[model samples]
Target chain A: MKVLATQTKSERTQAAILAAAEALFAKNGYERTTLRDIAALARIDPAMIIRYFDSKDALFARVATFDLMLPDLRTVERSAIGTTLVRHFLRVWEGERGNSGLAILLRSAASNEHAAKKLRELFKSQVMPALKYAGADAYAAERAGLVASQLLGLALCRYVLKLPPAVTMSREFIVAEVGKTIQRYVAGDE
Target chain B: MKVLATQTKSERTQAAILAAAEALFAKNGYERTTLRDIAALARIDPAMIIRYFDSKDALFARVATFDLMLPDLRTVERSAIGTTLVRHFLRVWEGERGNSGLAILLRSAASNEHAAKKLRELFKSQVMPALKYAGADAYAAERAGLVASQLLGLALCRYVLKLPPAVTMSREFIVAEVGKTIQRYVAGDE
Candidate 1:
């Protein structure tokens, strides 16, 4: 019962702000959307956004706080790691998870300094560590960065912009083809 | 002399518009920017944008046009080719030639329908035939798309974001490592 009631009003308000921010940011982007826009969307006062996230950058970090997990990558056969990684990425990105908004952030993160810093921190904490432990350490961080480019690029083509051929391809086909390339990236004969 | 003299005021105006659009689009993006804004930056009337480019998307397509002259790629040794291609690309993207804008368009292209369409067209015309001719017809379009992603991702991380590690690494090291991966994406160890 204590765990059930662990939810606090402030936390709920914060979550509401994040949720509203995601929709607006996704619909628009970091530059166009304002604190007031987010507040109006969340049906909360603009000050609440400042209260929870401290700044627009912090709010963006929370909105972009997603993980790229490869389904239990620790124990898989070394040969299958690449395919597994690519397939799982396609599943999460193209399926109901719908990474269109995240894709926008990734594309914009380069020029926008705030987004860029958060992205670097995210790669260091979440991505680079997993890649390092995966025994890709020789070029793990760089390779991880490269792989991110590929995944984000695919999202750009298939999810965000939605090209005809890319959109038309079945998941299995994409996994098989792109999977082969990523296979070399993570655990194949490189 | 005739060509220079024959350049009409309208032609100059159109060139100005394209120039303005490229800079603004690179700095901001497709959605956030407006014709009024482009006109203001160009010191021209907003109506000029519509008159010249017909539409924002059309103007973007015009400004984002790219040409990839990958000559005699097949005959080159596979090992050296990777490094060469990487170096060439790094040069292309880093130099003030056209690639900074190219990088932005490629990353953000997947975020917009018109831009994405143009990307697909660019691949079909510029990249696909090259790969196909190089005996990579099995999945040339997809492979080209992936390559574009890796390149754009690196540009975003290294140039636009200026991630220290990525930026610190020499062009040769990046080309050598990333070239190996790109080698696999092209035709693989057949």
Candidate 2:
């Protein structure tokens, strides 16, 4: 739920804790980041964190839940479905949020079990449903996996690995090129 | 050069160190893994690790040079190039080498600067050259980056993240399906 224009003090505290936790987890995977560190950054009492989210694990789950807010693919032209999905994700990754919540989950997954589980769950709950909802009834899971390969790979190289060529690609070029491949995975023949 | 059957005592020791180091680095990543851990696993004195390689960074560089041994894309049928590349990579990844050197490089890249630089260099020297040699000269670097997105994403999901669908995918099915996408990135019109 969007925080109302007049925010309650508790909700503001929760927001502060989440922002601090996400940045620390992103910078140093889950193992090295601690509640004390998060509390320090958030400027809240450590006990306040426990009262708000119960524990570090619970807070992590809350932080990791990301909605891609994919366009209703069923409403899009069947031929343009792939490009639309690509464009939407590009914006999500590059938006004012900078590294989206999903980026934190992915970056932390390499060394943290909780983050890895969160990553898989995010795919199952959020990504797969969107693909299936868009009319990829047959092999929807497989198709989503294929799409994940492309999208995650782009994120890794451009965002994490910071490979130069990938970092420099124009947004229009990435959408047109990556969209075609995703289009095939979503709607093209085997 | 392949180590000859007539290897000296020092050569044998160096080989043992590399094998142990690769396994440790692959499982624990570069930061959590230490020289002592590698030496214990290799049954060599820890000093020998420094004696042979001078430092963990140098030892890691030696272990991280993976050879994909891609087939000549120029020789491959233009229509079939993608599938062929996919099939070949599948073999390389699933080969007796178990976790390839690239896997270690990838796993370590997130937290280690040396590993990340080595990954970029590997792509520039090895993957980009092969793409250029295959007649992707016009957009070799960009094309290589696109291919890297698919291939690295597959490797991350299947090997590192161990995503169920990615891990369980039949070799033939992945080749047929992901290969189509790679083929597009490699030779398709921009």
User: All candidates' TM-scores?
Assistant: 0.66, 0.72
The number of the candidate with the highest DockQ is 2
What value does the interface RMSD of model 1 take? Answer: 3.3
The docking category that best describes candidate 1 is: acceptable
Q: Write the per-residue lDDT of candidate 1 for residues A1-190, one digit (tens) a residue.
A: 7853797988778778989988987788777889999999888999888666656755775576667664666777777776777777776665575454455455446335556677777767766666555555477766676666566556655665565556666778767767766666666355
- Expressed as tens digits, the lDDT of each residue in B77-145 for candidate 2 is 788888888988888888765645566567667545566788898888878877876545577778889
Q: Rate the local accuracy (lDDT) of all candidates.
A: 0.67, 0.80
Output the worst ten-in-a-row residue range by lDDT, candidate 1 chain A.
A104-113
* Model 1 regions more than 4 Å off: A1-64, A96-100, A107-111, A136-138, A161-169, A188-190, B1-61, B78-81, B96-99, B107-114, B136-138, B161-165
Clashing pairs in 1: none
Q: Which candidate comes out best when scored by lDDT?
A: 2
| Model 2 residue A171 distance off true place after TM-score fit, in angstroms | 0.4
